[model samples]
Target: MNISKEIVENVSGIDIVEYIIENDNGIAIGIINFGATITKIITPDRYGNLENMVVGFDNKSKYLKNFLHFGSVIGRVAGRVYKGKLTIDDVAYNLDLNLNDTHIHGGENGFHSRVWDTEEIYEEDKVGVKLRYISLDGEEGFPGTVETKVVYSLNNENELEFEVEATTDKTTVVNITNHSYFNLSGNFKENILNHYLKINADRFLPIYKNGDISGKINTVENTVFDFRKGKLIGEDIDKKLEQLTFADGYDHPLLFDDKIGKIELWESNSGRHMEITTNNEAVIFYSGNCFMKKTPFSKKDKNRRIALCLETQNLPIGENEVFKENSILRKNEVYKRTTKYKFSVI
Candidate 1:
């Protein structure tokens, strides 16, 4: 394994450094201290051609204004909070409504926009970076001074792992996940419509018209949401079902079946495949349904379904009492989770 670091840019007198870790097999991943964001993931295709498999910007300005949340660590809470209202230990707090009336992705000043303190990790079989961020009390209207640490490591086995842990000084709610837009075709050569996806989920959380969780969980049986057998993403994406139309595409939290194991994604054209394993109960599958007309990275015209995200995390604490209760992080209690993405050629 090999690792290198360089200063990408300086923002407000703080140096934004990028760390690139490569395995012996030639798979390399680049991450920056800014947002602890992943800038690139280059892997080999069937014919031994190396190409980027994730969506990212090339310059610092685009990353500084990364509204898409591409390749960033999403936190405090991963998904939308209903009406921006969160209550913990009988104390109600109103969070910033950055997305319509809902507080999404920890508000506008959330973890994705923060610069983290970083340290390098050199292991016998892996090379990695450990990033730390301290979210002050009342930042983005969320209580508690949260000290978050995220370690990203790449090993020779073609596995990229994320180890996340956080602690808060006050009672609060927290759900964290990585928002990495993946395209197995490599470098966005084509949209992900042809990708085959299998999610080991028997149920999914529905969303309202405004994209907030509807506080209901429905079985995937006989619905377009069913991916138990694996199918092309474009097969039923445009169906006129209420769930499909509500979010323009797939953007729901899939409840993982306890007996089932990992989620799988594959692209035959490039012969690339990925397996995702997480300790979290839910994974949000977001088809890139909201790409802008002129994105800073894309060379061609706007295309919505260019990539997809498998955001593994605890279910969002919407209006669901059970989920909210489970998402709570009491004072001095630690919140820890791990997710791994293993890549290979099919």
Candidate 2:
């Protein structure tokens, strides 16, 4: 495996660098540096048809002009912080409010909006590209200058392995992940209402305004949040629930039980099945309802549920003791998590 880097000029005058990784099956994935984003990931369909499974912009200007985080690595703090503020050691700090009344994705200037140092590592067995960046103290109203690295690897097993690591100077909160909107079926025309989904979570954290959990972990018996037994994704998306009106459908985090193993997803259209395995305690199943409705850059029509994000991460703002326990990483402690998504044909 010989990895190569090429400089391609986008319309926005930003010189974008593309890193190509080739797998044994002749499949390849292209990543860009403009936003530390996944430019393209080409895979085969049921009939050996190749298509791009991830949603993204066509060029660098679309990424700049549009608001789609696309397939970029998000960081500092991946999800929302209550009211654009967080308290550390009895001290409160204010962050930039990008999402209306709250701070989303590490405020207006997160790691996705920056350029990182990249290196392409090649090997006969596997190939990957590593993106590294450092955040200064108080950059997004968070403590410590954090050094972070994200490695994107594609192997012979058809698994996309995302390895994320970070270390902080002072004790600052960190939750990094790839904000890639996935339409695994490769058919964006219709909603993914027939897609069968299963999660190991018996409980979920209900999100509310002012950064508070609505209640304790609830059972998934008849509740709309139930996905434990593999149900159609859009089965109950339109129910008149209280949280649905506040954050839209399925915007909360799913709490995985300790006894559960790998999570599975089956796409009826493409016959593509995906399995996710991680060492973390929880996985956030974001339905992408806020894609273009709340923000700007999504290429989707407001009414169409075009994409879904299975973001495997530690709970949002791990500093919140009630929301996620044992999430705080102290000084001299290393924070590491690996999320692997394997593709298979049904």
Give me the candidate number with maximum lDDT.
Answer: 1
Pairs in steric clash, model 2:
67-297
Candidate 1 Cα deviation (angstroms), residue 1: 0.9
* RMSD, candidate 2, Å: 3.0
Overall lDDT per candidate, in order of appearance: 0.89, 0.72
| Model 1 residue 273 CA deviation in Å | 0.5
Worst 10 residues of 2 by lDDT: 318-327
Q: What is the lDDT of residue 223 in candidate 2?
A: 83
- After the best TM-score superposition of candidate 1, give how far the Cα of residue 244 lies from its true spot, in angstroms: 0.6
Q: How many clashes in candidate 2?
A: 1
Q: Residue 132 of model 2: what lDDT?
A: 88
TM-score for all predictions? 0.97, 0.89
